[model samples]
Target: MKNQSNMPLYQLFVHPKDLRELKKDIWDDDPVPAVMKVNQKRLDIDIAYRGSHIRDFKKKSYHISFYQPKTFRGAREIHLNAEYKDPSMMRNKLSLDFFSELGTLSPKAEFVFLKVNGKNEGVYLELESVDEFYLAKRKLADGAVFYAVDDDANFSLMSDLERETKTSLEHGYEKKTGTEEDDFYLQDMIFKINTVPKAQFKSEVTKHMDIDKYLRWLAGIVFTSNYDGFVHNYALYRNSETGLFEVIPWDYDATWGRDIHGERMAADYVRIQGFNTLTARILDEPDFRRSYKHLLEETLQSLFTIEYMKPKIMAMYEQIRPFVLMDPYKKNDIERFDREPDVICEYIIKRADYLKSELDLLS
Candidate 1:
């Protein structure tokens, strides 16, 4: 809140109308000429489609969108989406910074400054125009695909459990009668992080690089305290050139010590890495599990080694901590967690430590 208004220019995007008004309002003063242009024609009809590039418009313009557009003219404009105007928007923008710093960035993307309404807001990002890069038109051959599962098809596993728990209490239903069903749902909800070593599914890089790099990415998410790894948040696509599938992560809410499940806050990395018979078997042989375990350990060690996470974690806490207040009704639900910021912090630290210890053993 201190310097929220002093946001940088690159972080901001101006609607064509807004751009024209700003030019007129501050005519005598300096205004950054519109580097990026919006396709007002496209944005007018569909709320989902933010804008496409109009040939008449300038190059290097950007747009914000909540959903993917159906089409773009000539791969048109670069889009920096703040689809959800929530507490995590700034973090998503900063994530571009994080990826850039780590030197693992894929697309050309980063946060920039912007002034919107009377107040200055943070979390604006800039991306390279999609047209700049080659958009692969040739689809890859279909095969067995490994995906991070989203919600349960019938009902979200979490919702089903809650409903069942409530129903059992009202009636005289025995716990054991539904225990098996409950466990099945729990097992079903866990994500599949890595693929098995089959003749067809094996990657050439798997033989070269130690699995540490992939695990480190997962560890970064945990170190950030993010647990929202639903399917849409990530996709591993086959790079047309190399023919290798790489992990792409998305969705960063419910992170940095925020818990959606009230009392149910588990470390993100552990939730994914924790092995059951089902997960272990799905991953094929013991070697795959062992590799994953070692990767998990190395990831933990790397995250905690230099305290690379300290400043960013604390900064995020400072930024969003004030707004994490519970609603009046929900306050009673989390009374014990009130003022217990240390619990969240400690959970994150300990999880990191546990992974480090696991890695140490592997070494």
Candidate 2:
């Protein structure tokens, strides 16, 4: 959870034209080249502003990749998430830590101070890119099919079924395999999830996925109250060995009872079930619903407590307290910076209890 020594303080200097061009065309296909200096080593790197919501008129998040196939700490690229919405910049890292604790693969996160053209750009969360290196780090095969599920992959098979062409099924997913040729692996998965009879649905679905783990992942998302993540902001990876796709969470700056603007949402924000198509279908089965309820109880008992998370939350707060206060680019009220950590602490306590009550009612 602490900063790693291998990823140096990223001192980046980009040409004014390139920077302006990227800002002008925020969704460009090509990455603007920049002279990046990390640990006093200069390299030709391609940089691009990424993210739909975080693309501000002033500051934006970045996707950085090495031009020469070089890697820093075994990562060819890293996502610099400008957590502009989170007053407490530690939310994303803490969310990722919570996911890892819940027994799911999450991107490794670290805090970093970023400087562009000798100007400070506040603190940024440098996250591991979900690329080939990420899978290798997870000890999985190199050729595993990976898809970045965007807002289009809402898990609602109805959305895909209405489309006249198979190309529409690829709406929310961006394939990392670099092959545009449509094999319909994802489409068929969705079709079976939607069309399979209730009698044999679980058996057929489990053949292509770790349903228990997927259920846990869904429950984990709801427990954290990450409404933004139910549809998108995740990595869908087809496990090489099992040949089933597993859910890996991404983009949690809006989770943990916080809205996109970092304000608190209602305590009982998300429904206990039916957030997505696949999730709704799975929960309809009496057995799977029981498993979800059991998992929710187990999580609330095991790790979803103030006692277990307070130390980690406070440690992150202490680490970022100074940098965040000094950040001129940070838009949140300076007074609210340190105060939100305790709010998150409180959210953990309340969410665990609330989920317990809801599960009881559902049962």
- In terms of lDDT, the best-performing candidate is 2
- On a 0 to 1 TM-score scale, where does candidate 1 land against the true structure? 0.46
What tens digits encode model 1's per-residue C-alpha lDDT throughout 261-325?
A: 33435554445443322233423444655666565555455544336655664565444333233
Candidate no. 2 TM-score: 0.91
Tens digits of per-residue lDDT, candidate 2, 246-349, equal 78888888877688887897768887773877887888888889988888888888888888888888888777766765466773566787688788888888
Off by over 4 Å in 2: 1-8, 143-145, 160-167, 178-183
- The prediction achieving the highest TM-score against the true structure is 2
The candidate 1 region of ten consecutive residues with least summed lDDT is 168-177
TM-score per prediction, in order, is 0.46, 0.91
User: Which 10-residue window of candidate 2 scores lowest in summed lDDT?
Assistant: 1-10
Q: Candidate 2, 139: how far from true, in Å? A: 1.0
lDDT of each: 0.37, 0.76
Residue 246 in candidate 1, Cα distance off native in Å? 0.9
Candidate 1 segments whose C-alpha is farther than 4 A from its true place: 1-7, 10-109, 117-225, 260-264, 268-284, 312-347, 354-363
